[model samples]
Target: MKTYDEKHIRNIVLLGAAKSGKTTLCETMLFEAGIISRRGTVEEGNTVSDYHDVEHERGSSVYATCLHTEWRDYKINIIDTPGLEDFIGEIISSIRVCDTALLLLNAQHGVEVGTEQIWDYVDKYQKPTILAVNQLDTEQANFSRTVEEARRVFGSAVTVMQYPVDQGPGFNSVIDLLKMTMYRFPENGGKPEKLPIPDSEKEQAERLHNELVEKAAENDDTLMEQYFEKGSLDEDEMRQGLKIGMLKHHVFPVFCLSALHNMGSGRLMGFIDNVAPAAIDMPAEQAEDGSPIPCDPSASPVLFVFKTLQEPHIGRLSFFKVLAGEIKAGVELYSEKGNTVERLNQLFITDGRNRHPAEVLRAGDIGCTLKLKNTLTNHTLLADKQSGKQVKPIGFPTPKVRVAIEATNKADDEKLSEVLAELHMEDPTLEIEYNRELKQVILHGQGDLHLALTKWRLLNIYKMHVEFLPAKIPYRETIRKHAAATYRHKKQSGGAGQFGEVFITIEPYYDGMPPYREHPVRETEEIALNWGGKLVFNNCIVGGAIEARFLPSILKGVMEKMQEGPLTGSYVRDIRVSVYDGKMHPVDSNDISFKIAGMMAFRDAFHQAAPQLLEPVFDIDITAADTMAGDVMSELQSRRSIITGMDSQNGYQVIKARTPQAELDKLYAALRNVTQGKAKIKAVFAEYAPVPPELQKKLSEEYKGAELVA
Candidate 1:
């Protein structure tokens, strides 16, 4: 395979809202470059980029696909990413590795919710971007409105490089401001015919062209002086100025396209080839400690794995970008994460499902290798293990929804967990957690659709049938007021008798509370409970009332009760238990008898105490567009949420609230419906607050019924 230097390789990711023609654009690029003889439509499921079976089933892209095209003298590596927010992990990891983002804006609908969702990452990474307003051949296409909305959302850097001579169904001509010519396409739409601008459109064309010239010159002092002295910048000079503006994120050039009809794509690719910043042109990547790693092909090899997939016939394929130096098929590399050495037996440049064998890949080039054991997405492998230089990893968002998953067959339980772990390796957003307290295996993810797709993969790909269940909330049990109890355990058979008696007083535990005054606390131990809160066990028995040796057994029995509270099978926390007095028969008062006495006494006292249930609560911060803010706030109120604050940022409403965990399911579903899935929500653990009295009554009744069934 032929290898290109960093200057000749362009890594661009296609980002947009779903159905915004990204895959079509990729297919069109490949076709126009002669990489593919024919173009495939997304509806037919024949597009090379969206090759995953799941994507075909859903009729949309789910995974980020990598493809390449040799346009003119440059090999443009295209990473086609899914547009849905549920699959944001794929988009983010792709963004981290690519040098430029080719964002597509649907001409029919101005700036969409999904576009805003993706813009957050693009703006954060400061990647050089080129916006393509696509589907202009449609009747509802409004190119000017789309560009106007782009400027509003993304700021003044949105510079127009091309505008359609006519919009709507008859749109077939575009006036190129950079070249000062009009491109009139054939009826079928392939290469276009260049012609002089018609007098009807000449005036408006010159106005826009001058605006473009000023935008390009505004970025560089030298270019500005040249433009002011000569009244214009040449084509090459404009390219240089725009390249600088792109590198500094001060210019995001916009172009027009009908990717499906194969119009305007060639010009788009030409601009990308001549003006976009290559990896070599971009700033050096920074290490975790802020040290720069220049893109030097001769340096020691280092590659950061960005995405991986388990191809059914090909096993595991790991995709990465070489940060420095070159990698051969048989090269050996070491990962600092596990200090394990792995050999790259084979390497290939990928175009969706097909792979072409490659001898070597240089810096800034992306490729895939098969059968890597220790490397994973976001992991870096270095040729020199002792370099001790680690690249910063991609930051995946915190999981927003959680559900417990169980295997339909008990015997497949272990295999199910193993498969989920494998899937987690492929997609880091799918988190698996074995919540021991709830005795359920929980899957945490970005949304319901994400988890649903995970389940679909398990059943279809792995052939392991699994079902999702509502996760049980981890409620805590504690008391409100003080109460005392006494009980005697005695068992007399034919021989030895078990006999013991004890007294205990339990009150709600608070920090810095005075010790029990009825009797001295001889020995006290405060234990931090694993669930949460604390348990203070005090031995206040008078001298010789209960032997010191029997204290541990009593405490053990008390802990057992705390572990499984009497009111409900929940962990009890934040309560002080005082063992004031007890009687024991010398012969029958064994550890077993004292344990029974302590367990019975604690249960008796807990009945008298004002037991209450505490439910887990979460703090949620939501950012919604003005159009959906009222609906979002209304839905939040319906979920028993307490609004804490509201503010405005970037023309979006930011609302903060606290709500119980039990209401999270309702909140998630309601927010999606009310906001049309455009609002952003982040939830985190806040604290445990008392459950309402009526809800507490309902929970107790349900628990009792469950206990009866069990």
Candidate 2:
């Protein structure tokens, strides 16, 4: 291995829809560069990028794989990312650290749902992109139609640099418009013979060449003048102009490739090596405070960990991109997130499963180190004294779908927690939370496949069997009217007697609007209840029927009862307790006596005050194709959703709605089925609304039946 300057390093991420030849293209690139002896196929399960056991079993990439190759004095660091939406986190993390995104499109299906999904990220990050219409060797490949689709969907900036001479089944050569030449490959398709353009295709080639020149010249004023004067640009001038256009996102050069058959990949790699933007060409990396951090090898070292992986035998592997200076083995690095310093003992550049020892990783290069105790994904690592400056963290999408999971064997409870913690470190997008109110362990993720794969890892890797169930909704109980009740707790045993009487009035509570009582003295004591509401106790007892010391005891009893509402065991909220009258026994009316009496009284009053169940509601933003927006809206209405608004966004219909959490249990699946898997949905907690009377009665009955069975 050799050290290369930031200008000589091209950090590229391969992105596309699943089964679109991303992994295969990466394999072919590695072989073409002579990094590997031979190419591996996804069907054979021997590709370098998709090396994980889960990937081999599924014949798809489940995680992003890092691989590098040396071509023509350039070191290309390629990140092959999974195209499945479930693993979108991997794509996001990879794109954050790379300088360019090579979006591979299946020639058979020019622009697919997955391709559109990834294109959004590329646009979000504003990365310089190159579109490679792959699978040109397939029987149904149509280069012209694919190009037209690309222009229509992506825009006219998608100008072709090469066109397949004979596509579909017999695809063997490509005409390079930039050089006005033809690259004719042999039957095996390794190295191509560069030849002059044929007389028959010269006119079409000239027309495309003129279009390419115009697109490139638009990036720079000087290039535009030269193009207008000469009506064209030479090869070197075109490459330079295209690089600037790519950096400015003014032009995206499209190439033709059949990755499986190794056709046109060599030429594609050459184009990338020559014209793709380098790390230094990218805008300066931003610090947390929105300041630029220049890529300088002489500056203090700062590395950003974007991904972490757990190998079966090699402990934890922390993948990072050096933002400043160079990092060497045995250097002490400080982590602001972990607030701990650890020595980097070993540095390794990985090619999927294979690890190559590297002496140093310079600025703007990506590498991995073994067993970073305090360093995890999204953590910024810097020199010991460099504390104030930190790289901005990657903003990952929030998990939309969630499920309740529990160990099949109760004995694996501790093991389940431990394994989940490990898995969370590996994939930070997998959120594990214990809902105390709901009494369920919820696992949140991008989709069902994301959670399903996590369960597979738990059972297969961790050897812990688990069950997935629908997560329990955290419903709340509240009162709608004022009411009063009394309860007397009396226990006359042989030794001692427990005697207490409580009279309490309950009313619906609204913040900033206290109960209207004559001569109201600002609430004697205000208690913030845990169940999403407040409890204001009014000590309105003018005559000393109960001791003031018993006030705290009574409030405690009310809180305990609020934890489990009388109707359906849900938490109670937004209620005021007015202990206007009560009686107590001086000998037995202690904290315990008042507490029991207050609990009984509040429970009795809550039932009589028109208690109603309030279910959680979420604001949902759905992005679907325009044609399916009506169907989506209708489906949402069936789920009891209130359509708040609708608009168009980026050619997709954006529907904003508020729906109960319980009704959205299977909304992700339904939306996918309705929209033909081309829709994206996001949901966030909005507010709590009263459940319908019929549904509330049904829930109460179900709870009662369960209690009786128990």
Candidate 3:
């Protein structure tokens, strides 16, 4: 409830796999700082961070939550993020706005697939990080083995700054390796007591301390010289050097803590204040124009909206990070994407769903405000109109599953579009689109639960009720070989007579045609028809057989036919129709006559040639425990996934495969079951491939059944 200066601020993000005690660690940190009188457990659904209704029901974090605490004259703004792959976007957004990431690992599980999954994001951002081996009070806790696992997974750069005094049953205290001091906790409650390292583990602690000292010495020439000359460096100099290495990500300090029991929390807090880097110390964000802007408190205003939420009472709330300069309430800012200017009615720092009014926001600080027009997630706000620059947004993973939504009430259909648009603006990862050919409103997200949750939020928060079912996959039908056909359109209405004849050859479009070679006539309006593998029309009517004036009408007709496939009523693609010969009456052969003739000729030729349907495929990445790898592989095989390769990482297995999108629409829960909730997978749309003969028969049967019902 108090404002602090930049130097006194420590922006930290809690990141790890699900059930890794991130929420518990956040509660522990807050309680220890005396910010809260007592700690709240996840099981009780009373934690300050995981406060969402859905999070409470599931007993896991579903969205990123922000909170601040004062510890030892420092303001630590902690952002706790979801650990499941479905909500990984929340984790990335949180990391982007923080100075350091506190990666939590379950002591019993050691390093998990989720830990390995998020490490890549941290590495990509080059953000400084500290490892906390949590759940140390659990029955199977092993501090030494977890440290070794971290080293093996994260390389030798991971060094232990503190070690637990005991394992599993006897876990009570930690020894600060850098300061050569042991801090033991009270059996009941209160501050830790200073004590000497036990004789049994003194030698092992000394060896680990030497390794940390050597790593610190490598950071500076003077420190290395001191170590070489006296075989040891001064404690103060070593601490300073270690901080430098850790901030640069050359060294990642590992600390042991039982966040549930409040053990080792004090020492963890000490390491954060003494080691974590400030926002100004890290690199500043750049604009889309590739110009690096300094994160000075007085620089030009540049803010990025990292998250958005649809609240029942507040309407829409947007959370943003000020990349440069100070932003005050009621200031006018320009949106680079919208090319429109808007003012901040009021500004606030957000904690969970709660918003606290703040007068101004400085660089490197994250905050939010009420309704702003033309501003959405991933949009950049600028101080003035002249800068005309925007900050590049972080990349969000693509949705893996799609579900079609239908309005519950017939009158709600029109309103559904507007509501879905607002919801999509709130969560960029939730994609909504109207597939014209399929006549369905498609909603896509990370998985079935993600899609279902989106629909739930739309109804609950936005007051739009809808029904969800499997989305219709847009399959393409095309001919395999060249075939020629002819058709004639004739109509007689009173005095006017309509007559037209079209003779065309249909062929498949070849891939990889040079851009210059395509549409040599209309260079400005050249389309990538070949790239989409769609139908193409070429007019080569010599001696004016069809007349140049009728070309447009004929092309229009061919497009109409492409929408209505020759066999299964699916959209047609990858074919070329050549209007080489045709006859038309100048007065009677209008657009309608040519259109009818073109459609008939194209369809006849398509059916004569070998027609086939194309289905969507996805590239999948699966990360699971070594014990579950075999079961996961078998499951993938059952889903018709073709394993491309396999590898082991930190005692876990990673399987890369490709499978039909339809087969993977509901695999999230099955994967969780097979891996015992230890597996995480990410999937993206690859390309459409031909359906196998047996499966094609099944799909054809379904297509026919859908037609009969229609």
Candidate 4:
């Protein structure tokens, strides 16, 4: 392989819905570029991108695979991404580093739910995009309907660059609208001979070509003036105008493709090399301080890792893009993330699982290295430590599903944590947390399929047996009103005696509430609970009824009871405790005696204070196809969800509601079934609300108390 300058490198990410032929398109691109001797099909499980065992099992891409091709004078770096929205993490991470997104559309299905979901990210990032209508040879291919649907969803920016002359089983040619010619392919479809537009299609081709010319000229004043003067744009002028339009996100050129037949890939690659914005053409990457770091091979060296992978026997592979300067084999880089100085012993240009060793990679180029000690995804490595430069990392999406997982063999529990940690590093969306309050190891991910894939890898690849369990919700306990109770602790041992008495008034705590009026307050400590809300501890002791030194022990006892709530052994929050009076024996009243008396008094008052249980509530937004809107709504209502808003977006229904955290799992399953897996969902934490009386009673009864139950 050879190194390409920043301007000569073109990085593109293939994106679309499942079975939209993203992997096929990648393989076809490699074949067209002469990088591969033969093309591999997704059905044969030999495609470069979907090379993972899980992907082969599912017959789709589960992880984003990096591949490269050298065509003409440019080195095009390709990142083929998974199409399933469940693997959105791969798509997002790929999008974060790519210069352009080549989005494929299955010809039979015009605009799918997956396309709409991915469009949100592409639009958010404003990456230059080229939409390709693939599978033109399929029997049900409808190019016109697909174009109209794309225009409806993506607005007027969709400009057609080429159209299939005849779609369906016998499709063999496309009219190049921009070049004003026809490309007739041979039976096998590698290179096509350029021919003049036939008279039968001239009228329709001329009309579409005029639209393309105007769309291209609308981007720049110079091109618009030239179009107005000459009533047209030359081939070079049109390419320049379209490039500007693409960089501004004003135009998305559409092309016709049949990746399975190996048609239209060469044309698409030609357009990419000629017009698509390279990394240097797009906005420069920002440093930690929000300053742009331009791509320059001669500048100080810097690289940003966007993805990482762990090969079973072969250590780890970190894929990164050089943002400034160049990186060579055997170069040492400093990672500020963990302050580890890593040596890049080997540099390779990756093609699926295959790695081609390269001596050097210039700026704006994507490459991989092996055996980085501490660097992982989103970590930035620099050549100089005193440079004080750390590139900003990509913000990964939040997990939608939560489940408790443990090793099937109890002995592998510690090893399980270590493996999960490593998995989380490679894929940021897979989050793991050991919740002390619940005493469970929780795994959070995109959905059931996402978590199941993780489990499969843990079993097959890591040889660690694990099982998924139901995760528990973090419910809170609080009181509603004020109540007073007094308790005495007296323990008479053979050698010594312990005696103490405490009187405490417990009430619900809220912000901006006045101090206790039952007794003159001497001191107060407003402590915030670790779970949620606050705990107000008031010391109203006066006239030396209780020693000041003993007050600390009393507060400590109150905290222990709050940690394990008096109602259901959950964390108690938002409460006020005022210790007004207590009796302490001069000889026997020690810290232990006062602590026990204080805990018992708080518990006695809590029972009389009308305790309530609060459960987590989430603001959930669900996007489903139009036909499944009613069914989706009905399913939500069944879970006692309150519908907040409903609207339409790009031919889909957007439903917003507030639902209990306990119902999320069931709701997701129901939505998947009713919508046939076409719904997109996102959930965010909202304020906690009290559970129903029956549910509260059931939960309280189910909780097995440890010490203070009797």
TM-score of each prediction: 0.97, 0.97, 0.90, 0.97
Candidate 2 residue runs with Cα over 4 Å from true position:
512-514, 518-522
Candidate 1: residue pairs that collide: none
Task: List model 4 lDDT by residue over 399-474, tens digit each.
Answer: 8888999999999999999999999988899999999998899999888999999999999999999989999988
Off by over 4 Å in 1: 492-497
lDDT of 3 by residue, 1-710 (tens): 46655566678989998888999888888888887788889999998898877788788988888886678987778899988777777888888888898999898988887787788889888888899998877899888889888888888888888888776777778888987888777774347888888898799889989999999999888889989999988778787778788777888988877787787777777777767877777777777778876777778888888888766666777788777788889999999787788789898876566567888777777788888878888898888779877887888877766788998898988888888898778767888888887889898787666776676677666677788877887777776777888999999978888888998887777665432222222211122443256555677677766777777787778878777776667777777667778897877887788888988888888878877788888889898878788898898999988999998766668899998877886676688887766777878789988877787677778777988899
TM-score of 3: 0.90
What is candidate 2's lDDT per residue for 1-710, written digit by digit as tens? 78888888899999998888999899889999999999988999999999988999998999999999999999999999998899999999999999999998889988888888888889888999899999999999988888887787778778799998999899989999888899988887788899999998999999999899888888899999999899888888899999998998878899988888888888888888999998888898999999888888888998999999888768999999999899889999899888889788999888999999989889989999999897899998989455577888898888978999999999999989988999999898899998898898999999989998998898788888999998988899999999998999998887778888988888998888855584333346767776688777787765788888888898889999999998899998888888878898878778888899999999999989999999999999999989999999989999999999999886889999999999886887889889977888889999999999999999999999999999
CA lDDT of every candidate: 0.91, 0.89, 0.80, 0.92
Model 3 score (lDDT): 0.80
Clash pairs, model 3 backbone:
533-574
After superposition, candidate 4 runs with Cα above 4 Å error = 647-652, 705-710
Position 182, candidate 3: lDDT: 84
- Please state the error at residue 452 of candidate 2 in Å: 0.7
